[model samples]
Target: MATLESFLKDAAQGDLVPWSSQVLAAQRFDLSLATVEGTILYLDLLPARYQRNRNMISIKQQRRLFNSHAVVIGCGGLGGYVLEQLARLGVGRITAVDPDTFEEHNLNRQLLSSPRLLGHAKVEVAASRITDINPAVTVVPVLAAFGEDNGVEIVAGADVVVDAVDNVPARFALANICGAAGIPLVHGAIAGWYGHVATQYPGDTTLQKIYSRFKNGKGVESELGNPSFTPGVAASFQVAEACKVLIEEGDALRHRKLHLNLLDMEVVDVPF
Candidate 1:
């Protein structure tokens, strides 16, 4: 390992060529270079491997993750991807609620779904996948659906709530609980090539209002008939929006909805 002072001294004295090889080799433990006519000759260059070893998120940001907790409802296509991103980002704690099982159709977009996990409960499968990605993340899987009865308690301790459910009733239930708790709710929905995302605070334009008009008297249904790449895109936005809320960053999607039409590659942000 080369010290910073020595490295700087070598650079200032025009000895960087010799120092570079020692620094790279000592730090990476894998490189060897020869010199020919005062020019460096490299027998091998593994940029990807070297980059991976050096890749790291800052400690300050990693500590921020330990201060937050998020709840994700429905471990399907959108929820699956959302969980994966959140866990990868090192969110301290996560509570995932769903009362369904992984099916063959879900493999297309559900991050945790696979042929091997075909009949497993969605929450269980998702939790297993999240733990594999980041053992540091505390994933609590609730093998029960989120309803008025359990919504309030489930969301009370969370700093942010992510709604990736497919049902209008469930969305309304989660929105009501989060609103009462004064927690920011990250909402995402997908239908075919179109998807919508919004960050709603208590008393702001509630999800119930939006779904009431859109669903009318009909029951909730999956628009994609079968899972596809659309939910992955939408869920990614939801995770990003949730993280922004958690970190208290400026200019969140608060009181606004982002609509995307993947077919035409158009996006529109509508304010409430």
Candidate 2:
């Protein structure tokens, strides 16, 4: 079994370039490809895998990100992109929960959804995709709806839970579960050209406080329809908030909502 240390010394790329495919495949030993990537990242070798992350994220911060756990509930437009960034950013472990299967309607915004994946489970697809992107990331795919029965256990060990679910009731349920578990929750949603993101810590009723007024059965997305660009924009902000929570960096969206309107090209911060 060729270890990352020996492989690095032997190849001695001396820069950020990744080792040849042959070296990676040969020295991988019993570890999964992701494990190999993780080992290189753990040593702060840069390995081309995370070279761009340098300067932007100190090696210390990268290490912190590599050790964090995030549970994302939903595998649609927002969840798919959130998971993609988390995996690429080397979030150590991710638990993705979603019961829905990919469908034609999701092709526009869901990164893991495609015509060939129409009937496949969304969480499973996300897990497979993450492994392909960054072998160092451990992704746990849970094919179940976020609800009262399994909500707590699903989010139990997570440092942060991302609320990418589309419906109002499901979002509230996830927030309650995360709050009770003392975990931070990053919430995001998009409808047409509009989107919003917020961060809620334990004991915060931000979601309930904001959505309680909307007695409507569902989110505005149903009527307005979610386009490809809206979720992409919103998910980027959601990932930023999640990373901030994970690495304890930057001012978070806690107790505040960032409203984005692509049509009007406006951004506003509203205190909750």
Candidate 3:
């Protein structure tokens, strides 16, 4: 019986494991492609898709990513882009939660939103989209709002939670939920060309300070409106922070806020 590692080594093109090689290994060993992927990474071989993630992310860190799970609350604009990036980044497992279905208004900004998906549930679409983007990654779609009853359960066992909710109230609730679970939350919000990204570790009161000041149930987005570019930029930053949190490397955006104003051509990292 040949070891899985031996088969992977033989199939690999240099240090990179091609998708064909992963499929072959899974077929031979009667294992899942994810299992084969993990084996290759554990053996210090990089999957071809993640070859660009090398140098910056070592084989060990890539494997760490493969073992990590991130829960994204709200599969809307920020959540949509975040889920896409996380799946493509090989996060292994993702939980996408959202209560609403895709609306006509979503087409302007949401990556997953299309004319045919207008009436479809966001989380369901998110799950399908993630799987289509990365077959080896698992997508757990929860088609429900995040509230007191389901917040904790929604985020359970997640390595990190991303705040993509469009409202201030939901952000506060999500922060409390993450606090209770002791899971780090990568917070992101976008309105027009202005957006911000921050990290809230367990016991961090940053969300209170950030959201308490904004009453009226929602943030400035109600008036300004999110354009197509903001969510992509904001989600990109959020994924970067989440990746850092999962890999246990680099300085996370804790105790500080990364504020961006594309309209003004400025990106300021403000310490709180």
Best candidate, lDDT: 3
The C-alpha RMSD in Å for every predicted model, in order, reads 10.3, 2.2, 1.3
- Residue range 1-272, candidate 3, lDDT tens digits: 88898989988899998998898888989998888888988888888999888879888888999999999998999999999999998899899999999999999999999999999999999999988878888889998888878898889999999999877777888999899899999999888999999999999977778765675766678899899999999999999999999999899999989999999999998876
True-vs-predicted CA distance for residue 178, candidate 2, Å: 0.6
* lDDT for model 2: 0.83
Q: Rank the candidates by lDDT, best first.
A: 3, 2, 1
Model 2, span 1-272: residue lDDT tens: 56556775555466443746424643556556555555665665655667788877877787788778999999899998999999988798999999999889888778889898889999999989998887667889999999989999999889989998988888878888888899999999888989999999999888787787887676677789988889889999999999999989899997889999999999999889
Clashing pairs in 3: none
Q: Model 3 segments beyond 4 Å from truth?
A: none
Positional deviation of 241 in candidate 1, in angstroms? 0.7
Q: Please give the TM-score that candidate 1 achieves against the real structure.
A: 0.76
Write candidate 1's Cα lDDT for 1-272 as tens digits: 65433433443323223444444543443332211101221212211212222234333444455557899998997998899889877577899999999877777777788898999999998788877765546789999989999888788789899998877888888888888899889999887788889889888864666675664433333534534788889999998888777766557787678988888999998776
Candidate that scores best on TM-score: 3
Q: Which ten residues in a row have the lowest lDDT in candidate 3?
A: 210-219
